[model samples]
Target: MKSNRYIMILFFIVTLLNSSCSDTFVDDIDLKFCGKCAHTGRWTVDSLDFNPCFSTQAECLDWAKKNGYSDRGCVLCN
Candidate 1:
């Protein structure tokens, strides 16, 4: 009986660890640009606008350049 209890506990622990390690958010990794922002002053996963709209930092910077926001890049909104 003790062995069975131990096995159950082990199974529960394994299941918990697996769930914790799994990615629960978006599958595709999204990046955000924070040019000249106080947050990071660069590209990052976290955004002040809470908008992770670009797939790559280059794309985000491109948008910024095209939209006349090269100096203070705009956050790509979703």
Candidate 2:
């Protein structure tokens, strides 16, 4: 029916609006990175330790290096 078609169109418009708004909002928020350290012989998740979140990847990497960890990297958190 014409009514059903109109309802579907309205729903589509609302969905588009919501998705666009949410995308912009998410882009405005800063992403956090955490430092991950592991042993040279161990690459498993269980062998890695996660450090506190940093505002930038460089900071996370620097923290790992300063802590005397041989294997270190940064990972996105949250």
Q: Pick the candidate with the highest TM-score.
A: 2
Reference-based lDDT, each prediction: 0.57, 0.56
Steric clash count of candidate 1:
0
Off by over 4 Å in 1: 23-78
Positional deviation of residue 78's Cα in model 1 after best superposition, in angstroms: 33
List TM-scores for all candidates, in order: 0.29, 0.35
Tens-place lDDT digits, model 2, residues 1-78: 999999999999999988778767888985433234323222222114555555666775677677765375565543
The lDDT leader among the candidates is: 1
Which segments of candidate 2 are over 4 A away from where they belong? 1-47
For each candidate, C-alpha RMSD in Å? 9.7, 10.1
RMSD of model 1 against the true structure: 9.7
lDDT assessment of candidate 1: 0.57
Give one digit per residue, the lDDT tens place, for model 1 in 1-78: 999999999999999988877574545556554434435444423334433356557876776567555675544333
Q: Candidate 2 has what TM-score?
A: 0.35
